[model samples]
Target chain A: MADGNEPRVFRIRVRGSDVVASCAETEKALIALEQAVAFPRPLPVNVGCRKGGCGACRVKVLSGDYTTIKMSRAHVTEQEEAEGYALACRIMPLSDMEIEPAFLSPRERMEMRQAQKFAD
Target chain B: MSQEGLLRPGIAQLRVLDMDEAVKHYVEYLGLEFVSKEDDGRVYLRAYDEFHRHSVVLREADQAGLDFFAFKADGQEAVDGFRKRIEDFGYTVDDVPAGEMPGTGARIGFTVASGHRIELYADMDLSEDAPETNSPMIWKTMPRGMRAQRMDHCLLYGPNIEEVEKFFTEVLDFHVPERVDMPDGAFAIWMTVSNKAHDIAFVKHDEPGKLHHLAFFLQDWNDIGHAADIMTHYDISRDLGPTRHGITRGQTIYFFDPSGNRNEVFSGGYTAYKDHPTRVWDHNSVGRGIFYYERQLNDAFLSVVT
Candidate 1:
């Protein structure tokens, strides 16, 4: 729902899928995604803390304008961010965007799996 | 006994996200004296007590992790001996020319079994404000932040625990003062070449080249509590602290820098001697070994690394 002055519509490209979803612009990409769609099963986004302390939820914006909150360099390097990688939980969309979530490295995937189990 | 081999944890190079924020955290808040920032964009700093030109080097970069941790060898001959031994052990050593870092001598570096860069050097120019030798006051200047005495030790996380343990002992002459044994294999080891309980340590993790924390030495328990107070006052992000490690028995507080590299300020551990038996911990009681007061491991301590 567009409230004229309150919100704007943006299109997002889900990584590894052809589906494009229309999402309401929000403070964070994750929140915007949650508002517009839901995943049938977990796609291993590996998010935690959501405040940028942990290096989870990392993604790469393929195209479009966006801004991000403060983030830990441990997760995304400035060079990598400049090259378009970002943390989805910290990124705020400013225009129509296309992003591809980075696949976790073998070690990172295992660590996330273990951490999720422990958290449960 | 002569101190003729590895002498101390002499230098640490860290990558920071923002130079301004890193300076504020390390200088004004942590109290290290800013020595100089090179034209190449690296910042050099030292504790008030250190005689070296600098002990910590900060580079502004997108990544936040250790660049390398170096030890001060007793002499040029000793450095050469270690370099030869390291090469003989199968890892190629690269020479870092003198003046690559200001006020420092040539260094030899090689990757260790656990995927961390370890370096050794034998010379450094004494700082302009080094502790006075004659009629010296308790300190040349008043301490700030937690009044850190020295950059003490670092805990690293990576794979191949057995090989790393063997490399430190067989190649570097570091003796283990404490260790944790997991069911699968050796989970962790605290090693030292000097008298301090642990000069460096490592934990078993899948990731290579991950930093657990960089610790600095504080005076005593009072200083540890004061550090906690300072953390509260400045609103620094804290992980855990003002607790004791059942292994080294050091009083400690673990916090984070703006870039998310964990930092610890601790005091009071039993003096380590080569003759002392290595203290061992079983996986079941390992939580107590890491945090004596809590007696339970926190999730962050186990998983968080930069």
Candidate 2:
């Protein structure tokens, strides 16, 4: 349990980029990263679905001390979770960590590119 | 007046699809009178209203769905009513400091029933505005859809459908018009305080957050075809149709914006009220044709990885 007194440190890594920031609690870290980064879109961070059931938001922790809210079977598999993949939206960072976001596929990239061209 | 006591009244307008093509198409073909263009490339569009300036804003982005926008509550009292109800349900509300912009009036902050951060303001002062250059491809030659009044509703994607639905209905006091339960008994809730069926909805999905298409209601159904024809002329008719949704009784057409975000131009939706208690139904209650529709991305259009 977090005591709210002990100063915590966190090092976060966003996917497809090397920008990282360190901050005090998990929420502050997440919010700070959100404000600092110019994301291609709003990163789908977790709301309250911390249990991982909602899959509303998920991020993989590359290296860190963390815990996930209970997940639903439909959202994630035990094997996936076991493979160092934790939902970024659900887990509270306990210590310094690294993370990887499951990015869009190549074909999806093409579509996005085409859409961007049209917009421009 | 205490800022915490104020609730943003009704949705002013929602930014649907961030694509350039979609925004341009709406401006040129559908007859959405262009309002202003921001230096950051954000374009403001509006339908003529008795009260305010442009009702909707379309920002250029790589990903689609409802992006950020504002809401206008009835009065200071309504804003206060929302603040009380939100805190009563255990959530944080704050007053957005002034001078963020020149004309925007006193604005407060609160999360929506669905947990999205939103800003509410009263007395928007856009008195000294300038006109923007008109696009060459104006749809003056063709008929158009209902002059959309304002962006009124935002249908969001919620992976944990049940929890989100509960947050909106119980916490924020929105009326649930219809609920679709999954085979496992989880549910997607449609809640609204507006006369329209729902100002917001919680959809069940695999990926969560606001990764769904956002819509704006045209004044009438004919405007739908007008907008579609405009897109067709632009050679950008990705998709168009009149499909019904079981949850909110909305008839809609799905199309891509220039930025690859999905946008819907809809009309003929119902509303919820306090006197009429909300109705709930079983999961298998509605037909698949009306309730469930295909959301195919064709791999090429998928841009953002979240």
Candidate 3:
């Protein structure tokens, strides 16, 4: 759902699902998803030690004009930067892009649910 | 069914300093709940609307690194079995009583390969039943499929790769999935028996303490971006890109904590469970080099060696 005044600028594809929006940056894209689309479930954000030091909030920028902000070199290697990857916490999308979340799987989710049931 | 070799341990509790800071970070940032706090500056935190006493423990300490802790074992027999295996290697084992900590039950003690003190025990009286609160932010705006299962694994920086690897594989029964080699013929290994690529990874650090980073698994890709947005709102510095590793094909992002410890959240690691007698590669083999991308050295990594 694009606001009439907002220009139809770029598109973002998440996990093979294409999402079109007028938002220009990655942050805006996420906000748009929250407002415009119905997600299957609630997402978890553990932005622990937000200083890019914690790596807990990392996301991959598959395609976009994104740049990181003051990321520590020790945390990410030089080889990692060139391969079209940017930290979601530090990355600000300058253009339309696609990004992927790391480490989420259906089987893992089932295990978690089972763990919760056992705990209960 | 027999539960012979199952790692059915849940997080007993993480002990950290500064209850207020820990609470604010884990609860507000990570979406965990402050189940309870004590006057002694210890805080217990839980995740995923769970009824367990606490998944992480934050306690007051002069230093802010990981304090002593334990993982849950299935039962008394499992603890004894694990103890026999460890003691056969000539490491001492001790028995600690429950009630010393709020959520912890009975426990057996041993040291990890990285020389960290660890406890293995079972039958800590966990709260039988608890309700799941529909917290406003719990399930909204979630990625297509998002559910944090449990504390998946921890990565440690070890100076001696062979020593640590042997300790885990031989003494603790951890399986090695992949080992990347340094150009100079040394090895950096990732080991785990769980379905995920590596429950615990060991990287060669110039120094002898925990150097690399700690990682947790997420159930959804969208949460990665959402979590990043939350970090930006807090004005924290970002460390690295969310790149896919050539070796594991696992996507990863790295950052630092207030104390400068590195943490990583990665997904989609290739599993080696089916391949029971997995092939072991040489430290200088070509296959090892594929996963890691060559990066320009920065001052931080350089400083560690210098």
Give lDDT: candidate 2, residue A74.
29
Error of 3 at A7 (Å): 39
Per residue, candidate 3 scores C-alpha lDDT tens digits across A1-120 of: 246564445665565455444454435444444344554343332233444433343456677775566443333435455665443455555667777754212234336445656976
lDDT of 1 by residue, B1-306 (tens): 466688999999998877898889899888999999999999999988888999999988766789999999989999999888888888899999999999899999999877899999999999999999999887999999889989999999988978888888898899999999988889999999998999999998888888899999999999999999998898676777789999899999888887767899989999999999999999899999999999988757877777
Instruction: State the C-alpha lDDT per candidate.
Output: 0.83, 0.52, 0.53
Better of 1 and 3 by TM-score: 1
In the range B50-164, model 3's lDDT, one tens digit per residue, is: 5467666666543344544455665678778888888887778988888666767877776655555567767655443344355544443232212333445665554677777
Q: For candidate 1, what is the DockQ?
A: 0.15
CA lDDT, candidate 3, residue B5: 44
Of models 1 and 2, which has the larger lDDT? 1
Clashes of 1: 1
Q: How good is the docking of model 3, by CAPRI class?
A: incorrect
Q: What is the interface RMSD of each candidate, in Å?
A: 4.4, 13.5, 12.9
Candidate 3 lands at a TM-score of: 0.60
Which residue runs of candidate 2 sit more than 4 Å off their true CA positions? A1-120, B1-23, B39-41, B61-65, B98-102, B111-115, B125-149, B237-240, B285-306
Worst lDDT run of 10 residues, candidate 2 chain B, spans B297-306
> DockQ for each of the predicted structures, in order?
0.15, 0.02, 0.08
Interface RMSD of 1: 4.4
